[model samples]
Target chain A: MIHVVRKLFWDFEKEEQWLNEMSAKGMALTHYSWCKYVFTETPKNEYTYRIELLDNVPTHPESIAYIRFLEENGVECVSSYVRWIFLRKKSSEGAFDIYTDLESKIKHFKRINTLWNSVMWLEFIVGLANILIGVTNYFNSSSSISLVNVILGGLLILLGLVFLRAGAPIRKKIRKLQQENLIRE
Target chain B: MPESSERGALTEAVFYILLSLYTAMHGYAIMQNVKDLSHGRVDLGAGTLYGAINTLLEKNWIRAVEGEEGSRRKEYEITELGKTVIQGELIRLGELIANGKRIAGGESK
Candidate 1:
């Protein structure tokens, strides 16, 4: 059985955890898309999932080579969308953790934070364009479509702001790690 | 006039990884070697190992080599610069260990 679920943008970490929980309930993620996941049934707790932020272009040769390298190291590249990739390994093999120490953790979090910042900028640009179009339509045609466009543009900007805020937890974690490094020093 | 950033103190993971490359080995083999050499204490998680390998490659501390006997995986071996750095690291570690023993042994008191 394939299960479908919708997750919000801010829920990246939470959604990874939830998918693993579903694995424990006999499901493995076979496919994924923005805000949507397709999991097929499996033996309970057979796999463990991990999310890694892809800091390179997805279609780059090096990126493809790195994915192949991971496969050779026993990690299955299940699916990826934009800046994140979902990787899983058999539970019997061991944990699926990649970044174990604080320094690497900080770097990882920083990458994720960069991804969110890029997304926010993209959304803000699109929203601005939409509002400009709306204003032009209002002056040119004086139609209801202008009012609708304006509302849609405003909503997009609001969504962008929310995603910008979604980066807070990652930033907070980076700060904590830096503080620990200071203490250790 | 100045040394490279790679000449400074290496992190624990990087240190072990470079040491493991004394013999040409692939990712998984290096991970296992580090664990065994460190008496199971210095385990390299896959992600950490991956990042460390890339950084080391960028620093020219290690290079990818063809595996022996038709193996397919990318094997890595330490470069000449890596050897010099590892020697420096060992001397630093030796001094640290000596100081730690002297303080704990109460020889000065």
Candidate 2:
């Protein structure tokens, strides 16, 4: 049986956990695109899922090499969205963790932190530009278009603030990992 | 100065990886070799191994072997410079062991 689920997640870790939960319920994720997921029915606990953000787009040579390496190691690449890849291995494979050391874990979180930081800045710049244009339009001639632009600009800024807030936990994770790295590896 | 800077201690993963690549092995073979060499102490995850391999390649510590055309599995081997670095590390480890044994006063176990 095939099942399709429509959902969105900004937190990769949470998404991984949710996918594992779905697998536990006998739904093995077969594909993913943006906010959509497709699954095939399978025996419960047949697979373990992991989500990783590649350092480059999936088609990039480096990314392809990395994926091929994972495949050689028994991890299957199920799907990709932008730079993020969904991976899985048989549940009986004995703890399929992609990062086994403190340094690697720290590096992974730092990558995620950099991503969120870029997103927040991009939203802020675009939002500020829209607000500036809307204000100029309003002053030049009063119109509903100006009001609509102002409203949309305000919403974008608000979304930017949300992204900024979302990045806090990732930053906190990086800090914690760095502290641990200092004491250990 | 760059050579001196590179003399700093290597991470456990890098050390094992370089050691494993001395014989020109592919990725999965390298992982297994590391695990066996460490007596199951140091296991390299695929992602971590990929990152370390890239760094080593950039540093010219390891080079890809020219395999038969169209071969999907690529092999890597340690460079001469990499051998020098690992040898330096061995001497450093030996000194540390000798110092600890002299001060701690324990039989070599």
Candidate 3:
């Protein structure tokens, strides 16, 4: 039987862990889009799940080539949204790790950090613009505040703050890996 | 001296990649060859190999080979410049090993 789960994740690592946990309980992810995940019943620990951000969108030729390369290596691309890809390999096939070296791992985290940083800035700018619009509307009409605009603006800013908080641990991870690289690799 | 800027020590992944590409090989082949050559010491994950391949291509150290018609897997081979870089790296490694053996008093393997 198949099961559908609706959820959202800001942290890829946490999402991967949850997927693996589900797989360990005999639920293997069959598809994913936006915030919805489709799973099918399977033997316990049938597959290991990994989530990665590609350098390009899934439809891009470069991303296609990359996905094909991974497929050749016994890893399967199950689903993708934007530049983020969901990958899996059979548990009996041994460990599945995308970034094996310090440099690559650092680069991966930096990519994630860059994404969060950019989204945060975008949300902050849009939120501020919405607030300015609300203020202007209120002043011109000399009436009650534009409650909808203000509320929407506040929510956006709050979301931006959440993004900022999410980015801190990624930055810390990058720094830790870089420090290790200096002394070891 | 211009070439000297590019002559710095290659990362273990890059070094093994160039070595494996001396003969034409695809991404999966390169990964397998690296592991075998390193006696299973170095395992090239797919993502790492992809990034390294692109960087090597950008540097003109490796070129993609035309694969058989209808084949989706692309192959790559090391260029002359890549061969020269590895030659220099071999010499550098030789020096390091020789000095370590001479001073540290370990018998040369």
Candidate 4:
């Protein structure tokens, strides 16, 4: 059972659309709280979902539209205890469990991550090396030679910035997906 | 105009995507081709790969073709524009390799 808290910042249309699509595809769901919903059935029977949608702005049209979408699609089982979506296996005789090939994919993600990390570290080392060389040249050489130090310093700074710009997002995405996989297991 | 400028304009993933589409493949096929061609060096996530495919479709570099039902997915083919980009990339890479060889004093034969 995995629970994720999502603050409803945008119009609920997107969330509503996803829920409706999932429901149309056949998944049993129950709305436990104003902010909490649960899915009892999924491709993986071992999974459950709990989401907390915080209304950042109560009067926003997006928020109202989301509430409306939920209202239009959900059926009330009891006063507030309605099952928004319900999913059950069509037949109890067949295998309902999903066998995943995600492990190998995750391993490959780790390999990409390692390569990116090494590149970033190497970039940092190269920047530091250039900076050291720049400073050494600046102090021990003529004015004309010192101009080269200025160029090297600028190049190192640009290189460091570029490496950080490219590597950070890749690292974050890989880490989040890795966490998701770990949580699922 | 310069080799680095051209290479910098296109990423390794974008390069692979364009190269794979040259043979006219589907989303899943392109993903499989990237993995196979890179010898497992690149493995794009389904979400990311699909996102890239959609972007390429919007850019008009790849067009989707109807595929048969059951086990077959929709196919995509590279457009003339896509071919031009691939051609430019090849020339850029060639120039880079040639320049590098010269700098390393291996340009003699």
lDDT of each: 0.84, 0.88, 0.90, 0.52
* Stretches of model 1 off by over 4 angstroms after superposition: A128-145, A183-185, B1-7, B104-109
- Comparing 1 with 3 on lDDT, the higher-scoring candidate is 3
The CAPRI-style docking tier of model 4 reads incorrect
Q: Please identify model 3 stretches exceeding 4 Å from their true place.
A: B1-5, B67-71, B105-109
Highest-scoring model, TM-score: 3
Off by over 4 Å in 2: B1-5, B66-71, B101-109
TM-score of 1: 0.87
Distance from true location, Cα of A103 in model 3, Å: 1.9
lDDT of 4 by residue, A3-96 (tens): 3333331222244445444545444454434555554344533222222221223246743443332232221221132212222222332222
TM-score of chain A of each: 0.85, 0.96, 0.95, 0.39
DockQ of the two-chain complex in candidate 3: 0.70
Residues B49-76, model 3: lDDT tens digits: 8899999998888999997688778989
lDDT of 4 by residue, B2-98 (tens): 1322333455666788889877776656766988899976755443455466667787767887765663456788887777777888888998888
CAPRI category for model 1: medium
Q: List the residue pairs that clash in candidate 4.
A: A11-A62, A27-A86, A27-A87, A28-A86, A28-A87, A29-A85, A29-A86
Q: Which segments of candidate 4 are over 4 A away from where they belong?
A: A1-185, B1-8, B69-72, B104-109
Chain A vs. native, model 1, TM-score? 0.85
Candidate 3 clashing pairs?
A: none
Is model 3 an incorrect, acceptable, medium or high docking prediction? medium
Q: By descending DockQ, how would the candidates be arranged?
A: 2, 3, 1, 4
How accurate locally is residue A137 in candidate 1, as Cα lDDT from 0 to 100?
Answer: 97
- Tens digits of per-residue lDDT for model 1, B6-109: 54467888888998999999999998898899988776778788888998998888999989777789999999888888988999899888988978867656
